[model samples]
Target: MAGIYIFSDRADIAAEIVGFARAAGKEAFVMALGEEAAQALTNAGADKIYAIDGDSELIESYAKDIAEFLIKAGAELFAVGATPRGRDLAARVAGYLDCAMASDVVSVEYHDNQLTCVRMLYGGAVQEKQVLSGLSVVTIPAGKFEPAQGESTIEALKLKADTRVSIVETAPIVKEGVDLSKAEKVVCVGMALDKEEDLQIARDLAAVLGAELGCTRSIAEERHWLPVESYIGISGAVIKPRLYISMGVSGQIQHVYGIRDANLIVAIDINEKAPIFKAADYGIVGDLYEVVPLLTEALKK
Candidate 1:
């Protein structure tokens, strides 16, 4: 049987990984970054736990130190969460081991001592199955699997690894408002907005609905109307909100990947033939400039 290693910040998710590994007849070792995370992974049925603590200000240095330990642990198939931190750590570790890494994997299976991973491509339009031929690193998206309950038996291990980098100072960029990922309702603006000033109209609609504002890659990158991190697509954030409102987004395969899991999708595009309408639960074919302001006022009232 192949040995599986799961690095997780949340114990529940770590346990779920452990369950999956056990079901596949693989030996599972869970590594946690903090005390709380360690305890949680142990409760989830981790055979071993590596607990490390450091200031969030020096995350890169801390992750490097942990990566050393992970390499020494001899994980044949390694997995991590597809979060910002997880991706960063996975990249660093994969580079150090000279291994291939896959991100946003939805599922994994083991057959004949080989690990196969399934990931969505072309905006959830296709599921790609990859069989890792050698040592591989995989980052899985959240909400892809259900958490399992288990007895807590955590075995703490000490790491003698040191980091090459050192932190000097840190300054955080704090944005005022709700995090789009945590928002139950989200309004996504696309390239069809036509003018930069039109973004404020979408913001107004979001404010009226108490939702967070997001945008497609074109609006976020090419136009610079929104932050790159706020962009949604196959290469960006995958949101599974209760309601997702897409305004003027033409629904490219890359952009549609992010909102495929939304409970209700309402799309507004002047072109009735827009691909977004095909996936939307409800669609309005009209100008967003007139429709958005009206919708905002209606919602406010």
Candidate 2:
């Protein structure tokens, strides 16, 4: 019988994919690339864990070789997290296997010996359903499905070959603050601020709420008010914050696409008719300059 295979650099996400496969009533297996990956995957719902002994740098370089392994193992459906690197690896694997592939899949269903998926399109303005013909590959977006839970059988796989790309040294990107992807709460701003001085109010609000400060592409790339890392959009970071508060943002599709998974969206804008209100759970029709300080103070109490 063809089985489900999940590839993740992250054990948590791999477990989640395993959960998805189990929900489809198929055998779920995870390919993990670290010492503790097998145990972690088992705890998360994997039926079997294929532990590849390697660091992230090595595994990433072996994306193609991993695909070869999947093809030999006869994985009917292969899945990965829809992060940037995940997408790239999945595409490369699909190319190597010459199979139909999908990216940023929001939902997956097993049907008639094949897989069907719902995914975002056109900067997330539409959700499209796609069915794969054979040997399917997919990228599962975060927050779409809760992580799967169960214990798994552990197996070890060793890469007997090496790739051209090798990591001589590795250094983490030093950020001065919290990683936005992991932040549960975020306060994002748009073009409403007339000057750089207005950013302090946004920062103050974020501080009060103990949230990360984010912005649209314009604010980060065009206006240079924030770093590129702070930008949330299709070409930037994708966040699933519990509470996403927006100020001065007009709610463009590219910007709104990033926050589609947010639990509660609060929009503060001068324009009541702005597109943001349509997407927000709570909205304030007023100047952010006058409103943000008040909201910050209220939270401070």
Q: Using lDDT, give the best candidate's number.
A: 2
165-187: candidate 1 lDDT, tens digit per residue: 55577689675434566669999
Of the candidates shown, which would achieve the greatest TM-score relative to the real structure?
A: 2
Estimate the overall C-alpha local distance difference test score of candidate 2: 0.83
* Structure candidate 2, residue pairs in collision: 45-150
Per-candidate local distance difference test: 0.76, 0.83
Candidate 2 residues 89-191, lDDT tens each? 7888888788999888878887775688888898899999988987879998766667887666888887543556666887988765457777899999999
Flag regions of model 2 displaced more than 4 Å: 34-36, 53-57, 158-162, 181-185, 207-211, 293-301
Stretches of candidate 1 off by over 4 Å are 33-37, 52-75, 95-100, 111-113, 122-126, 151-162, 171-173, 207-210, 221-230, 293-301
Q: How many steric clashes does model 1 contain?
A: 0
TM-score of each prediction: 0.77, 0.84
Worst 10 residues of 2 by lDDT: 53-62
